[model samples]
Target: MDHPSPPRKAPTLCSLRTGLALLLHFCNVALLSQRVCLSLTMVAMVNRSEPRGAPNASLAAPLDNVKNPVYNWSPQTQGIILSAIMYGMPLIHIPMGYLAGICPVKKVVGSALLLSSLLSLCTPLAAEAGESLVIACRFFQGLSQGTVQVAQHMVWIKWAPPLERNRLTSVSLSGTLLGPSVALLVTGFVSQSLGWPMVFYIFGAGGCALSLLWFVLFYDDPEEHPCISLHEKDLLRSSLAEQVSSGGKSVPVTAMLTSLPVWAISLSGFAFSWTNTIAFLYMPTFISSKLHIEMRENGLLSALPHLLSWVLSILAGHAADFFLARKILRLVTIRKLFTTLGLLPPALLAVSVLHPSVSPLSSVVGLTLASATAGFCMAGLMINPLDIAPRYYGFLKGVTVLIAMVGGLISSTLTGIMLNQDPDSWFKIFLLMAAINVTSILFYLIFAKADVQDWAKEWQGTRL
Candidate 1:
């Protein structure tokens, strides 16, 4: 028998794909900064009563001198404003997810960044214009940013090889955590020194600049990229030949809806979102109330969880790829193992932070570790859609994120209501989050898979 030819491998050199992931990292940074900018600045924007002579002199001095108009919005009102983007997101995710397949993903994502930037610019004016306009602006911003989120899945579909999926997606999506990490670290100082409105102005203008850069750099696929090397192109073409197909086939809507793996991804996403939403949007407030940290310190400290999470997510990506490459476990087993690692520890840690005897330093440490551990899920559910349905990954992502964001909406609203009724209700909140996290992981373990579904395969009979 003739010996089989060795598998083609791309040269170990600078990769356009890695550059693309980095560019996407910046794009994610810009977009998510817009998303969380208000979360941090809202501390300065809302004139909540602090204890007399609270050590927020840095923030107070700016307000006292600049006379930045602070709103006396109630807790419920603040919750509504924080959750406004979630409302806009649901309206656009499914449509944009479908559009990601048919449209130029670069244009869709670039335009979204531009729109989001413009909306961020308008946020202060909208706040001055009235609460409704601010809410409307945020809703539209959500719609715009939602497109970016859905479109990225399409980019991976075209660019990411099967074995490299975890690394590429993790490197790119790490921006999600990194954005908020940077935002929280800076927004407090910006709000204090330049006025709260400058927080929006600065991030919004940066976003617009990034959009221009995106137009110059991003391409939808390898063949379309003028600068891609022949070696890299050939490697991608051969490696991805099985996982992707030429265009024109309709998405198998009914089959995808009925797939248990899809449900597993969606529900697991919801579980993750419930906790993540609270962490991103409310952590500053939680710290202020519980630890009595001032705005500047609050911002710096609040960023630690997400920063640690961001770092660990990138590491988890590499670890995941290592496991996959080594053939140490089946694909489904690796995903499930990582998902368990992601969910169970964090759930227990979240509840631990509620202990009465836990010092302020210990609470912060516990919360930071919990957030860091949760990053493992990025290797789990975040990339599973690509494994099972690369052909319709965008559509699958849209559906999954829509369901997941419902948890965000509910979590924000419920947290607000609970806190509003009784400020000392964090115990209840942590319990609920832990319960949801555990319950969802069990379902994911039972149903999740890594094999490409029948409908996702091309006529060539290759599978991802």
Candidate 2:
């Protein structure tokens, strides 16, 4: 008996649907840029460029209160402002993800991001009004952007072919690194010369524009897209045969809550987010404090690490797909390999920073290398939820994100507390991050899988 021939390969490599999906993912992350810009730009906004009525007057003054409308807040207050987003994010993750999984996800995502941009634009106005307004603005921005991860998963389940899953996911997720890098590079100059308000205005407006463009071009699924090719559509549907949900999945609360794999992924996210939150929120400050590098220079230098991270991240994605396509290793083996690569360098690098003899140049290089390792996570932690539960990808992502947001909040707030104690206090923080990194990876390696969990399929027929 002859077996059926393999389906004929489509002449097209990737269709318009693929391009639109990737670009839409890229735009979704531009919203993340607004947050990074604020973290870096606030430094320039609050402090003068030199010392006042003295040598280096611009740098010496704690505030250019007259020109900059500076807020000379204490570290505790600053921490609260910086971390306000996390406050709203964890609370909304389950709701946002639940809705995105059931609703017209593209519209839901677009509207959420649009609201974030509008809230971002109102930030300057909020600052002008009072600190409370600024805090409220950030809180609301968090609430809006919180749904973004799960919403994108919703899009990807419909768009990524099985073989192309790593590529699409990694490339799209690299936006998380790329957007923030670009924002860091640009925010300081805009804040320094044009004023901090200009940074917000530029990034916030770009996010708003990008969100509208996304709505115009992207559909939630292949069937709804006006421009997708037939072969591409067939490929997507066949590749993701099991994900054809009717948009009414009963939340897999019991399975996700009990699964070792889910818990592993969730804890991994927490560890990664904690280390990254510190880096994201305060790397510039750390460099400035240690090396006396000015804020603009700090911003530019900070960009290098994330720029490398983005490039390496997408490359890691492609590499993972290549290994799988060649049948070079088992899927579980591949994931563990990448997760090992992704987590250890960062842990070791974090440990290096604690050494008293580490030079400024070495410190910077170490952190950059750590970032490069972080890129490999695309092959593992970042994409594993979809691998394990496409049907519940949204809710799985939401739960993981909710746990991770707490990590972010604690890191941000604790960093402020540490900064006040002494420079040596950084040693403890670095040690904590390193411990979290290696420990989380062990949990992932032991419990993670490269196949779908049973719960993802249990109610599919009944719902779809």
Candidate 3:
């Protein structure tokens, strides 16, 4: 009998794991750019003929030259449109989370992102048709975009080794901040130079292209990847042996719903979402209204906080892994410590912007610090679901994020109402956010854990 040859392994010159990280980062970048493009573009899209006391001497001439149609949307209307994206997000998370367990997660996420991108392409037309149509487009975009949030976590189940989880996940998630940062920095200029519609077109097209690339390049599991080397596959298999099951199983619904650690993660996510929603969605309006910055410059300034956040997000991940590798701190302690670092100082810093004689520089510094510090949470409660329920991380993430989305939706709509009622209500909003941050961190400290829960291990008898 002829001896059987060993199975062929792909070349190991390029690491598929790192490739996955890069693709995930860009996926977030594409998805988030599409999501936040409206925030900056809205500044240029609105008819601001009447000055609200901000100096516009330099911008008046240039703005007059641009002939884009400007809508007369009130603060309330703008808030509704901004929050519309979140409306459909909650509806899809649980369903998508379940689907990720049974389906090829890459396909589900790629298809959803592609649909969302297509909707973004139609946004300008929707706006031209009516504000309702724009809101509808945003709502549907949220429905599609929401699937990515949950399903993407499933990819990590088979790919991220336990020891490197923080580094991989954080690096991938930093794209969330970087995506919006790039959008805020460029959307105003793009809107001004090529009309507001072009901003949507460029980002939407980019998202669609990325979606196509994901379909081609990414795989649900390392074993399924043709280009993944044998050594890499073996490494992942040994590292994830206990964590991931061979196939999907029904999640323990009652156990998840009753778990304190689960609630801690969900509530912590909610608090972060509330503060982040205010910072990202309303910062442009705040800078323009309070600092008297022009649209182009407003985009630049608004981007500073997010850029810092993107940098710190990656740093926090490295730090978390460093602690874990050295056994410097227990996993639970590390999670709590990072959570405190992320939430508490930012809350204080946000409140500092309420100073009576705050200068533009001081206000910018405060807000930037607030946003950057919050990025530390990426390695804290944000990744805790994976620690406790690696097998069902997708479903757990969906549940937590569903709660978080509610926070984002309320924060946006509430901020809009407050600002509409009194444009100077930012002080009150900051105070409320500070209170929320403190309360959230306290709950996480008291109840959060890093060990795998018993119910989460029932399917595979995992012990990490």
Candidate 4:
């Protein structure tokens, strides 16, 4: 009698690779968070109650004194300094995939962070020199980190299996939220007591340290890791047999950029990022100027929304994996639904937050809920790159991140022009953000899908 073999057991998630990936992501996010704080901290130190009817407060700089030397860059100069990072960010994404393809992903990601950390260490010295140096250093910081996303995707391509993809990607990316939260909470105290320069020095030190740790522990291929057990490695190889190829040619650039799936993911990511950069760049200022909160207190208050956002993102990732694993819904349906759940409610709630009649406490609550719910997109658009093209995930990530960086540039610069120090005018900015979020979700619903595209494997026999 012929008997069917028993079904293979699903692999466990308690692998060393998962932990290493998570930690690398967490540390990189922390580096990003610290750079974000420099601008907000400067705003606090330089503005110094000027909006409380002080003369030319927006353009004033403190005279040389005991605290770290000051630069009185104008509002226009400050705007340029903040946007400098995004200017360099968008230019590097397209090239990053090629770098990741040629080099070990850990080398690419770790080296980039090391450079960013070194740049962060030099920021105070550059700032004291003049505005131009500050802008130049900030731009290069963004340049160094631009490759991080693409490199991480390259690592995930060789590491994650289908059943574990959602949880793995979301957990790794949760640093997007945690980075800013930690930055806001800690930077305030570090700068307040130790001086503003320590903010960069303390944060940059971790990035430099982690790059060396990453080199020691991480390997680009499952077969290459010194620490992985034989059984787990075999499972990984077997799981990846069809999805990835060891002798693959470069990703087809025209095929990638022209693909509908890529554009859908990229466009939606633009909207998601537009809303997010608002929180990163402006939330502290809003909390401080509007609610009568001080800078350190404002950092704490600003951090609350991000902390809740982080928790919700993790829960959302787990729930997404659960739904997909049980086959309770189609993967495509689940992704679109998650997008709606994340972007729609946040947009609807954000409008109410801007109402003049709302009290500061009520406004804070409203913003928190909106931000927390926005975390669901982490499980949706963010992970779709690996879903559609495991072999070329790095390239796809570059495309999407580059698209989103354009939105970051626009939102950051526009907010600077729109808010000259007045809290009352901020409601209009919130509404504009809500409208963009709503529109982006609508477009995503029409085009987004979760299945691996046929073109994903089309490069197998083609010329390089």
Candidate 5:
């Protein structure tokens, strides 16, 4: 009867440890939450700066005179200044990437924001002084912006888990689409009522405020954050341990440049960039001329395609992850399938635009479909760096971006030449861009790989 008594259960070591770890983790997360909340509130206050004129004041004077004698600037001149930020970005991104490899991401990111804010502050003053000063200010702004982009990608790699990488990367990249949405919605109203100078002032001040918050709140790694609980920190560390272990110490810039995979990805990005920039930068102009849409309507309509693009990007990323998790397809197959499908639509849509009998609505729909489809390619090609070398994601992104920049330059020049030759022949330029998009698919199908390559394995072994 005594032997039949129920045995008492013992507390397992793993259970006890997990409980203690969770308790510590929560405490640390609470502290971090408070800091982030405070930082966000401060940023909100900075963003509340009022425009120069009363809210209801007429913006027509500034709007009407955007190309007037006071500035004596053509639309082309203003475009050059606005685009300078984008153009100069690729040039500095490479060096900035190397710096990110050596320096703490938080410092690199924070410093770049600080510098960008400072440069942005100079823009209003420059414009008031002369067009030359404006160009100079924009050039510096481009450099700083490029540095920020590189550093931001580095931060994401350092902080986010492998599984969550695409989602988080989308958040950052979405800014490319979202920034224009904000500008189109607000900038016209702001410039119309307040003045052109107010635009730069608001953006500059906002950047400065964000820089302050970034410095105070961001930690390069979870382990380095003062407020993170030991348990949560451990979780973060364990999740990324494999990736960290696999990534070799940083190689020389020349060696990185010579990497076959790197070159392949870069070349692919170049083709994608050419097609994408042509669609985004020139499509509205084409629409206005061909479809007889007003400037305001054109701006709004142009934004619709990118909205479709943003949605498709999320869906594609999720679908890619799903296939990857089920082991239904290799990463290479996943990339190839999506990228090829994405590229095909643009070419088809470009052909649609060439048809003289196509209705304007049909043409717009075709263009929208093309932009939306192209976004899926980003799910594969844009994310390849994170797949192959999580540690060197920033450096690789920089290299690809530099290559893409050349493509953008070529696209711009080609567009200008085509327009000069025959403004009515915009369809010809689109056809050329469509060819580039199609060629990108061929390159990816032939060369791009989803898995880590021999060089990476060799590098990892040497480092270990």
Candidate 6:
């Protein structure tokens, strides 16, 4: 009787607790797996939508007297036309982010794709119409492009879990880099073989294809995914429920803006974006003008740096996750570390301009290294929004992007002014960028921290 009465109450209690823990862990794993599968599929679909065409071809065609009827425009004009998208991005991204916050992500993304594709298809028509029409089309293309970028970020926030977020984000964002690579390579070939208009036509067709795929496959949340398995759906609901129970509500817009860390990240983003825009929007021109390279050569050379950066970005993303898993660095520290390291090279390379004897190839190589280093910053700044506030990541991202667009606008205008004034002292413009990069790094080091601010958590509770 005594033996029966004592029958392992401790063991039973331990067994129950163990079972619950196992169940919870399994739920998290299952939910994460489902999210990963869905995210990968969506990212692949989104990646397909990026504009890629012959880089060399796109550049060379406008210079060719026979193929390019509008060859009368100067290189600066061509650069402006090509870069009109970056110039208009900041103007549109803020509203686009808010729109994503309110609307269905799938519809918003798909609609943007459809509109962008339609506009891309019409780009050739604009060329035939007139320069003003072409400029107008470029502006429209920029608006649509900005919307697509914001929508994709929003979709990732909604669909991806915390653990998988960085890699998934990297994969999604790699489209920006990859799109240019493919465009440079393919467009180079297509523009050379077929014509400049064919580049837009091909990208348009691809965009339309991706729009259809997105409509078919994407859902706003796991609860709504028709193809999700019952077990998987249950797991997702359970995991999300736990997060909802534990985490505070979405942080209010006003409170988020008031936070120091938010501005720190925003400032870092501004510098990072300006550097990226300079490289992406102006590198071709730099190679052509400074290096005395022909347009075709510039396109091929410009593509190399981006291709290098794309690879580096993927690696940096994975490396960041690995470092986080080891607890070697907090999220904020990791961002700062990578961002500081990445930013330094560009600043140094800009100063390399002091030595004018450097060969064009050497200059390209220096610029490429600078760009590749900047790619690592994406691991920090690009993925930090998820680290800070998963619930309002889309909105925060919108804010950061809006801030960053100021840099983009500055880059475009400054480049124009510098070129108009004395294109040779482009090194001075680089020096200005270097100062911005250094200042941003210092700001982030001082203000950015991984811990959720007490004010932020309290505000989230009240707001939600």
C-alpha displacement of 74 in model 6, angstroms? Answer: 4.2
Pairs clashing in candidate 3? Answer: none
In model 3, where do residues sit more than 4 Å from their true spots? Answer: 1-14, 50-67, 246-248, 459-464
Predicted structure 4, TM vs. truth:
0.91
Please provide, for model 1 over 219-252, each residue's C-alpha lDDT reduced to its tens digit, 9 standing for 90 to 100.
Answer: 9878989999998898888887766533646667
TM-score of every candidate relative to the true structure: 0.93, 0.91, 0.92, 0.91, 0.77, 0.80
lDDT of 5: 0.59
Winner on TM-score between 1 and 6 is 1
Q: Which regions of candidate 4 are displaced past 4 Å?
A: 1-13, 49-64, 245-250, 421-423, 460-464
Q: Can you write out model 4's per-residue Cα lDDT over 1-464, one digit (the tens) per residue?
A: 33344224345457865786587667657666756877567654464533343322233335423454445555556667877888888888978865666777777888888888899889887776676887899899888878786677776666777677777777887877888888888877876677777888877887788878878888888898888888778777887777764234766677777788788888778877777777777777677777878778777877887888888777888888777777776788878887777777767777897787888889889877877777788788888877777667766788889998898889888887777564367777878888888888878888887777777766644333
TM-score of 3: 0.92
Worst 10 residues of 6 by lDDT: 35-44
lDDT of 6 by residue, 1-464 (tens): 12122111123123322222222222222211211111111111111222433322222233552443332343345545655666656777777766677788778877767777777778767665655676677677667666766766765444444444555556556556655555555555555566556667777777777777667777778777776566545544554553421122444767788888889888988898778777766666566566766444555776777678767776787777666756666777788887787787888886685476987667778888887787787687777766676556666777888898788767766776677567686778788899999999889889886665555344454343
The Cα local distance difference test for each model comes to: 0.84, 0.77, 0.84, 0.75, 0.59, 0.62
lDDT of 4: 0.75
Q: Count the backbone clashes (under 3 Å) in each candidate.
A: 0, 13, 0, 0, 2, 7
Give the candidates in order of lDDT, highest first: 3, 1, 2, 4, 6, 5
Instruction: Give the per-residue lDDT of model 3 (tens digit) for 101-150.
Output: 88888889899989999999999888777789999999999999898988
lDDT per residue (tens digit) for residues 1-464 in model 2: 33344344443245764586568657756877877777787676454343233211233244554335565455556677888987878888888777776788768878888888888888877877766788899998888878675677777777777667787788888888887788889987877777777777887898889888888888776887778778777877777786655257577687678899888888888887887788788887777777789878899888888888888888888889877877777777878888778888888997896588988889888988877678788788888888788777787788888887888888888887887666557778888888988899999889988798888766733321
* Model 1's TM-score against the true structure: 0.93
